[model samples]
Structures are given as C-alpha cells and as structure tokens.
Target chain A: MFKELNHLDELSRRKFIQYSAKAMLGVGLASTSNNLWGSQIIGKPTAKSVIYIYLSGGMSHIDTFDPKPGWEQQGPVQTINTNVAGIRVSEYLPSLAKRMDKMAIIRSMTSTQGAHEQGTYFMHTSYEQRGTIKHPGLGAWLNTMSGKTNSTLPGNIRIGGSNNAPGGAGFFDSKYEPLHLGDPNNGLPYIKRHQSISEIEMQERLAIAQMMDLSFHQKYPSKKVQAYSDVYDEATRLMRSEDLQAFDLNKEPQSVRARYGDTKFGKGCLLARRLVEHGVRFVEVTHGGWDTHNDNHELVSNLSNPLDQSVSALLDDLHLRGLLEETLVVIGTEFGRSPKINVNSGRDHHPKVFSCVLAGGGIKGGQVYGASDESGHSVAESPVTVPDFNATIAYSLGLPTDKVVYSPSGRPFQVAHKGQALTGLF
Target chain B: MPLSTPQLRSFVFGLALLAGPLASPAEEMAMEEMQMDAMMDSMQMDAMHGMDETSIELFDAAKAVLNSYCYECHGATKQKGDYRLDQKSTIYSPGESEELPVVPGKPDESALFKRITLDIEHDDVMPPPKKARLKEAEIKAIKDWIAAGAIWTDEDVRSGLPTTYVEIGDEATNALIDKINETRAKAEYNAWGDNSVRVDLSVTDKDKLKEAIIGLKDFGTRLAWIDCSYLELSESFYKNISQYQNLERLHLDNSNVSNEDLKALSDLPKLNYLNLYSTKINDDGIAALAACKSLNKVFLGSTKVTKAGVEKLQAANPELTIIYK
Candidate 1:
C-alpha cells in the first residue's frame, strides 16, 4: 500500500508539472500536452491578436488608392485629394479619402508571380510556393506564436465561404489549423435552445457525460484519455461563456449597420470587428469574385463599389472606435492588372507591379510610400515585395518577423524570408 | 451480415489457440505474427464496414460542405485566421486565449457548433454575417465532431492522440483606468505628437469617446484632434490649443474662431486646416491666412470670400483656394 501511494504521488507530481508548463506556454493541454511538457520556452510579444482581410481576386491599385492622374492614357482614373495633404486617391473611394489619415498606401509593389494561385500563396504566406514544402500563412504563424486565449471560440477564424491560400498551420501540426465557418452568407443557424430539451435535461446529460469521463480518467492514465477528458471540460466552458455574444450582428446599432452598407462584404467587415472586439486574436475575412480577366472595368465597378464602401466604413468605424490603432488593416491582391490595356479592353495579370495598403497599428497613414512609373507599368521608386509588406505588418503589430521556427523536418524558417520591414511607412 | 454466436465463439477459440502457440516463441511466433497482422487488417476493414452508413454519409456530406463553402477561406490553400479545416486535427483549442473552436463530445460547449447555431442577436455566429447557412445535415456533422470526443485523429485511432489583460468588476475598471492613465503619462512620442500637453477631458463623462481618444492618444502619440464644435472654449483653451506647436494636423473645422483667432492661428507653422467654414470670417480673414506658408489645401467652400478677395488671396498664395461659391 505504501509503495502504491508513492507511485501515485509520483504520478500526481508529474501531472502537476505538466499542467504548470502548459499554463506557462499559454496553449491548451488537451492536444499538445504530451510534447509541450518539460520544454524550455522563449518569451514573445503579448499583442497576441490578428485581424486579416483578404481582398480576393486582385484589387486594382490604379483605380483605387494609387490614381495616376498625369498618365496620358489613364484608365478611367479620377483623383481626389484626401484630408491628408499631398495624398490623392481614386475618385471612386471618396469615403476612404475622408479617412486617409488612418491608412498608408504602397504604390510601387512588385512581384514575379502572375498566376492567381501562386501570387495568393505568396501574399498570404510570404513565401513563393516551390511544390516541395507547404508553408503556413501569417494567421497560422500568429496562432502558433500567441496560442489560444479562450477554449471556446476558435483561435483563428476565417469568415465567408472559404479561406485563402497557405492559410493552414502547415508542418506546425494540424491542431493549429483554423475553424472554417460552414457558411456565413445565408445567416447563422441553430443557436437557439431547442424547446424539446429542457435546461434541466441538458444539465443532467452534461453531468452524466462528465461523470463517465471522470470515471474513465481515474482508471486510465494515458495521454489519449486525458485529451478526451480535457476536451469535454473545454466544451462545458464554451457552452457557458458569454463571449458567444460576439457572433450577434443584431447587437450592433442600426446606424452602424447602415454605415457598413447592406452588402455581404460589409456584413463580413462588421463581423470581423465584432470578433476582434470579443478578444478573438485572429480573424480573417475574405471578399471574393475579384478575378477580372475580361470586362475588368465593369466587374471592378460592380464589385469594388461595395468593397470600397464596406472597407472604407470599416476603417472609419474602427478609427472612430479607436480599434484601428491596435488593429492592423491590410488591403492587397495576388498580383496587379497589366499596365497596358489588352485586346479585350481589360487588363491581364501582371506580377511585376502592383499596389497594397496598410493601416492602423503603428503605421504612418495618409502617405504614399512608393511610386509607379509614368505609364503605371513598373516600380519607379521603393519597390515593395510581398514579404516586405507582410514583414512591415508583423513588425508594426509588435510581432517578431525575424524569429525562426524549425519545421518538422528540422529545417529553419523565419516568419518572413529575406524581407525587411517598410520602416518608411511606420 | 450478423455473426452467429457459435461462429464468434469458434473464432475467439481459434484466435486464443493461435496466440497460445505464439507465446512459446520461435517459428510459431513468426507465423502467429503474420496471422495477427492479417487479422488486424481484417478487423480494421470490419470496423470501417461497421460504421453507421448514416454517420459516414453525414461525415462525407459535412466534409463536402466544408470543402465547397469553407475550404476557400479556411483550408490548406488559405488560412485567414491561421486556421485550416482540411485536416481534423486543426480544430480550435485554447491558444493565447481561453477560446477553443470545438469542444468534442459537447456540441453546446463547442464554439464552432455554437457559432453555427447562434442567432442573429449573437455576435459569434459561424458562416459569418453575410454568408449562407449550412445545410441541416452539415450542421449535424459539426455536432458530430463534438459527440466524437472532438478527436483530432483521422480514424479515431486511440494510439496517436496528439491575457486577462482586462479584469472584470468596477474596482478593476478603475484600477485599469488609473494604470492606463499612468502609462499614458509616461508614454514616449517618437516624432508623432507632443506628450506635454495635458488635455484632461476625463471629467466630461463621455466614457466611450473618452476611451477612444485616450487609447488613440496613447498609441498614436503625435496625432491630436481638438473638435471644439460643442465644447464651450474660453480664451485660455484656444491658447492651450495653439501651444501644441508639434501638432501636425488640427481640425478647427466648425469652431467659433473669429478673424482675430484666425490671425492668432497663422502663427502655427504646422497648421494644416484653418477651417473657418460656417464661422465669422471674410476676405480679410482669407488675406490673414496667407501668413501660413505651409497651408497646402484649405476648405473655405462656404466662406465669405468675394471674387475680388479670392483673387487677391490667390494672387498672394497661388497654392491656396479661397472659396467663392
């Protein structure tokens, strides 16, 4: 009996140390408990949150933020000076112009990949795809760095129909992947309590499950059993968290909804803000159908109008609420449209030159950091690469972009490769 | 496809006999190992076959829904929130926050499950506010993940297993406010804004706006906006406003500044906006604005500048715009 007691004590001590380490690492012990225990950890920044907005299909810089008014053959580009002096944007973005002081536009972005998939992967993960190894996207990197703050809501959330390229926590393990919303276009489903099941019944059922799991846990002393047990506990906590209120759009005022517009993109933007407001560290909202290979102007006008209104409203709303300063808003595309108009009166995908915008966090706003050439063809000054853009964002958010993490294969990789932060923008 | 009790018994007896011989080692062990491998493979096949067809169908349907609707934004191709759903293991668990996506075996506890089931009044609804809802069956599959112990395994293989920054309560809020104020006082400004100007509007009782401005002031140290639209400002207030010499952008757009005050503002070298828009200012005030050499753009759209006064101001400062319309 004494020997058994000592054995039990040893096991309990091990368990205590394991739990302590997991608490220190700031990650859930249900999944990674086996590997994380007994590991010496490094300290990172505490701004463990991210909000990603992917402007799927390429957003045209020429017709949006970077209007080349002096070009003789400028394509339907009209310039309007913003509140920020010496900063002029396309006339289509009047609402954004009013809030220009909250954003930074990069005009001289250059890339080498023209295809949508490649450019999308490059922009999302800051690494050119080599077909050999898949890399994790920026959101995955943040989730890995910060871990989860709540055991209920997903650590990373991607709203809308689908996620972007290289968005998963590749190599880091499948456990770090995002929780994709099944469908967000129609509306939320089945959140109400069922009339058939009384609250007492629900409580009784939960209690029964807890008791069974606890009994099993007492008999079984394996990581697998513990993982299941912990998951059950987490589920109970999630059911009780008031943070569930973050998903309710009706909670927002009517004036706020009208300000965001009555479009899909607008609603997604509002949801993004709401999620971040609830302390969801990373939330990615995608606005798709941007692939304008033909009839670019018509498509851009149709799609970009809503996007402009929604994004502008989001920025202004965030700024007014003071969330913009801590929340970094990025607007970018896979690549850019061709400088020269094609035979179809549209622009083809051109990776050589493009544009992207950054705002909030510690970035300097209302300033055009780079310049395109006279013909809107190539970079004329301070060419910004995809890595540079992402690096600057990570840097401004106080994330260590240069920190290296090894892959499962023992190969070292930095959050960004060979790219410096755009110090001029900040 | 049901097995007879006698067949099952015989099978167990045969398995025990085979194991008994293997326990002695040597050639029997090798033979038994081969048989065991085959039996194990068959058992796996049988287990797969035994899975409820409805559950299998639901799982496939759920996967299809995820691929069609969610993979675009949260799959291996793209992870908007550093999250992917291509694999089962990447489900939400506590990371930096206390939030987890799906708490397996408890649909009510799983945020993913709840988010999908949330009403319009809840802020954490899944599929987002704009997107379509999952099919009834798809929702059932999400619920299934919770029922299945929220396992992160491909085959439910038991073998693999793999900041409170804001505290609650009134006291905590007050403590947080005090700490925040102290930090704000000590916060450094790097070419953004001057920190010396103590614009104490805390006593105004405007909680949300005050928090916004304070937060902005803390992060964006160099930027300041003094909207004296509704505030009753005295002579000393204007003097204090003018003292922020490091002010890069100022919005006195609809302020009650007179020609005298406009003259006083001309001394501000960095004054970007001298918006005397619905205020008492005439062509003489426009002429006084010519002293501000750094004034690149001005909004005098509804001002009192006559055509001749505008021309006079334009002549003095060709870069400036004196509204006549």
Candidate 2:
C-alpha cells in the first residue's frame, strides 16, 4: 500500500517524496485509472499538465536543434551524437543528447515577427501584437478550457518571469493572470502569519478587512474591484491548504536536488515539476540571457550546460515518477539566432527559421520534424509558424483549438490564431 | 493583380482622359495640364501589369466576412468537422464527405450561405449559440462574393493608393464645389475656414454624374470628404479624384469603385476614411492599400471578399479597422 502525507507538520524536509509517495504517484495512477494499467491508449491524450520552459532572448537554432557542422555559419561548434540513432546536438548538451528519445525537435520553426516582443507574443498566442486588443496567452486559454487542477493553487505559475514577458490572461479576467514567482527557493511569500497572531485572530482580521471594503466594492462593482477580492480569497485558500507544501522545494532530497544542478533555472525546473505533481496545470519557467549578440559560443556553452542537465533530469525524473505520460514538456524561445556570424562573433535575431522541442504528453520521441536549409538561413521543408507551434502544444492537451472566444472588445480570438496543429508529431 | 495603387490610379486617369478629352485642352496645353497628362500616361503604363479590378474587389469582400465570422471555427488553427475556410483550395473544394461549404458562382447552392441565412433558431445556423451573430450586411457580402465566382487569388490590396497635390485657383475651386452641390452633392467647407471641404454626394442624381466629375477638380487638395455612394463612379472619376492630395475621407460605397479606382486613392496620404461598401473591390485592391499608411479604417459592407482576403488585410495592417456592417 502506498503512503500518503496527510499533514506537513509530521514530515521532515528530507522525507518529502518518501512520505508523500502516494500523493505524487497516486494522482497519476488515479487519473490514468480509466486506461488499463500498462496499456497504451493510442489517439487518447495523456497530458493533463504542461511544463513550458521558455528560453527567453533567442536561442540559436544552428547551435541547438538544427546543427550545420560543415557550414561556415555554424562557426567552430562541434556536434555530438544522441542516443537516438540519427539525432545530434551541440557538444555542450551531452546530457540532453543522451535523453533525446524523450524529445521531438522541430528544426523549421518559423515566424514573420523578428523583434523579441512581437516574436514572443506571436509564439505564446499565435497572433501578432496589436494595439487595439490584448489576446489571452495559452496558459489562460488552457485554464478556461480545462479548469483548475488544485483548488488552492492558481492554474498557471511563472517562475523568474519579467515585466516584459507576454501578457498573461490578457482578455481573460485578472484572476487568470499567472501567479508570478521571482525565486523558486523562496517559495510563496506572506503565507505564514506573525508569531503573535493566532489562526482565529488572522481570520478575524481578514473578516474585518472584507467588511471595511464591502461598501467600496458595492459602489465600484468593477472588474478591478472583483479581481482585488479574488486575490484575497485565493491567497487565503492557498495559505490554508496543505498542498502549498509543493512550493517548498527544500523538502526535496539532496541527491534529487543535485541532479537538477544548482543554477536558478535548474531550481525553477525542479519547482515546476513539483507544482505539476501538486496538480498545477501550467507552469512557465523562464531562463533569460540567451540573446547572445556577442561571445555567442562562450555564452551558449555556459547556458547549455545547466539546461542540458536540468532538462534531461526533468525528463528522467518525470518518467521515473510515471508523470511523463501526463505532463507535456516544451522548450521554446521567441526565435533563433541567425546562422551568419557577425563582426562581434555573435549572431543576430533570425525569425525566418528556428526550433523548439516537445516531449512526453502524446508526442512521439526520438524524432526531428522539419528542416532548415544547408546554410540554416531559411526553412527548406515543413516550415512551422508560431501559431502552428502553439496549436501543436494545445493539441497535446486535447484542448479544442477551433473554439473562438471573444475578448471583452467582442473581437474573436482562437487558441492558436490561424495556425494549424502539426499533428504529425504524434 | 500585383499592380500598385498608383499605377492603377494612373491607368484609370489615362483612360478617363482618353474617353473625354480634358474639359479644356489644346495641342499646346498649359504646363500643369501637360504634367498631369504625363503622370496619367505613366500610371496607365503601370496598370497594364495589374490584376483585373472587378475580380479583386469581389475577393476582398468575401474574405472579410469569412475572417470575421467563420475563421475562428474553420480557420488554420481549428477546423471543426474537418472543414477549413482559411485556404482557397479547401474552401472552394470539399475535403470531407459532407456537402461543399462554398460553391463558386452559386451562393444559393453553397452550404455556407445556406447555414448562415438559416433562421436563428435552426440547429444548423452558423455561429450557433454563444457565438456572435453575423450581421445582415456581412452575410450579403459573402453571398455576393460567391455569386461573383468566389475568386480566391493570393493578392494583398491594403498597400493603398498614392496622393498627388496640385494648386488650383479660388475661382476654379468655387466652380467645382458649386457644380458638385448642383448635383445634390452636399459640399461643405471646413469649420476652420481652411481650403478643406466635405463633399457628400450620397444623394446625388446618377444621371448628372458627369457634372459632379467636372466639379470635383476645383476642390483638389481642399477636398476632405466625398461620399459618392451609388454614383457608379467610372475610371475618369477615380483619375480626376487622385489629384486631391489632402483628401482624408472618401465614401464610394455601392459605387463602381473597382480595384482600378482603389489604386487612385493611395496617392492621398492624408486619407484615413474610406467606404467601399457594395463596390467591386477585392483582396488585391485592399492589398494595394497596405501602402497607404494613413488609412486605418475601411467599410466594405455588401461586397465580394473571402476569408483569405480578410487575413491578408489583417496581416498587412493589424490596426486597420475594417467594417462590414
């Protein structure tokens, strides 16, 4: 019989997974009960959650998914073979290469938006930036379609997100906006009350605050006011729920922690996995600083090392926990760096063609879809637009991509704009 | 089909000049007149390489309807029941075992038209429940687009026409505005008393269209507004109107405003308002208007446009306000 952690007070920090083995594996097992145990349910969606790893600032395609070893634009970067017979990656990503069977790489990811803000917006919503209306991001759309996984936790969380990140919950109510977290290690703030204050006293104080704002809320009765009330209600629920323990990554074992590396991004990935295990439907962990306009090789080498370890570990860890089948892991960027070397020995933004990786979920692994030309300047075949890429992600979650939801402005917007899902990935 | 708005404008102007020898012209015309003639000649040469104006207009109207009403369900991202309206080949041809959604040259027979026009309570009515209803005019536009052969070519017309300003004497300006007013073209001067004026010929008698054309020349750059709806504006009208550099608002709805005429509007850099409702313009014409940076709004109610045309326009100018209602 599997053991479930009923209370946080009884558990030690190191025994997080040991005592809560049932809590982690049970959710997976219960969710998959509809399918016969060990039987593969073909054509049926398996992903109940998505872990989106956004490598903000463009990551160079040639250095990552579309390697052109003999081409001059590839510079001096060397290619290493992956466990997947025909697949290869940069020498910097040896760990990720070994786990290539878990990944499906799209080498011909293309977009018309070359600028960072526009490209990122395009990638997230499958629509171009416009001044008249704000389109909802995929997280919010998925939340609307699938509802919340954990009653106490917001459906979507963004770790290390910046102000410039694409707008969250755009057309959706503010309640749908991603709960932003600056540091994975710090966990959720303001959850614990002062030592002097008792639980009853805290409840009394909250009730008083609500009573004081009742008149103001009645007078205004606006979306902003309602959103303000929702924040308090949600925060209160989260603080009181035992599931909040998922945010405390210090509960993880040292060996498991070390496998993910010591970098901030690595810790963020660990937190994302924990959150998903705790029933979070969407978690975006952003790792910036990839806009390598100068010292491309040196920076990429440093960046790829942590990414390689963390992502590979994430895949293996998810698979071991039997969570891989239900969790879709996506690694993407706004676009890729140009294949041409510039005066500073770095590449510029290249939106014409790029790459992204999809793993777990229903995605077939050990394969690469689409391809860039010899020089890697353009897509030679299977050019996937930003919307197409987004549609594919939505498809994995079994979300209806065609359902049109109108913004507050009465204009229609879809989950993937006008992009067709690359269903061939399955 | 790839003709720039300027080229189309010049060609139409040249044709107009050929049809009706300038009101006053001699072998040795004045320098300004001669220059205008030369400009028209060059535009005509460019127009020779452009697409058919009528077909382009029809395509634009049909496209706008599909994009606004149908694309959410049948577009690139999603194709409920395996029907896609985003692509031309697919929209015109059925991919599944179901009936064809659109049938070129037969709007009545088209499954798309039938569903859209069905009673709101019907099970097969488009936009079913919770979805926004298709405006009556938008439905008419789609029907007209199909009846016009549903020409679905990959052309963009939002690039816009060019603006050319030429000085005219006060006497000439008064004569033109007066001539327009005689045809019931409500010609009003700007409240600021500037050279600008608004000419509304929406109620003008079509029989006196020739007089209205003669009167428009004098207004020139001062012409701020002109509503020639249902006036059957010919090639000459577009050529003559192209001279208005300060022309900002124009209403040619229900007029013969073909792609050729659309090219003429591009020269007006200051033009922000345009109404091509029920006209013969299409995706190609609107694609040309993409060059007109100042134009942000266009009305194309009851015209021939397809979903592809609407996508093209939106792709070129996300800020553009296209009204089909």
> Each prediction's TM-score against the native?
0.52, 0.53
lDDT, residue B173, model 2:
59
Worst 10 residues of 1 chain A by lDDT: A37-46
TM-score of chain A of each: 0.81, 0.87
Q: Per-residue lDDT of A306-357 in model 2, one digit per residue for the tens?
A: 8899998899877655467668999999999988888999999999999899
Q: Which candidate is the best by lDDT?
A: 2
State the DockQ of every prediction.
Answer: 0.02, 0.01
Which segments of model 2 are wrong by more than 4 Å?
A1-44, A215-224, B1-325
Give the Cα-based TM-score of candidate 1 against the true structure: 0.52
Q: How well is candidate 1 docked (DockQ)?
A: 0.02
The iRMS of the candidates, in order, is 20.0, 38.9
- Residue by residue across A1-426, what tens digits does model 1's lDDT show? 223322443246335434643553333332343222111112212122566667777776676777778876557767898999999887777877888887888888888788878888888778778654578877666656544434355567777746434657765545456656544443334444468978788677666555544543454443423533454455555555556677778877899889888877788888888776545667777788777777776777787777778888887665544355557888878877776767776777877877888777657787888898876789999999988887776666445554545443223356665468887776
lDDT of 2 at B207: 60
Candidate 2, residue A103: the lDDT equals 92
Reference contacts reproduced by model 1: 0.00
Lowest-sum lDDT 10-residue window in model 2 chain A: A32-41
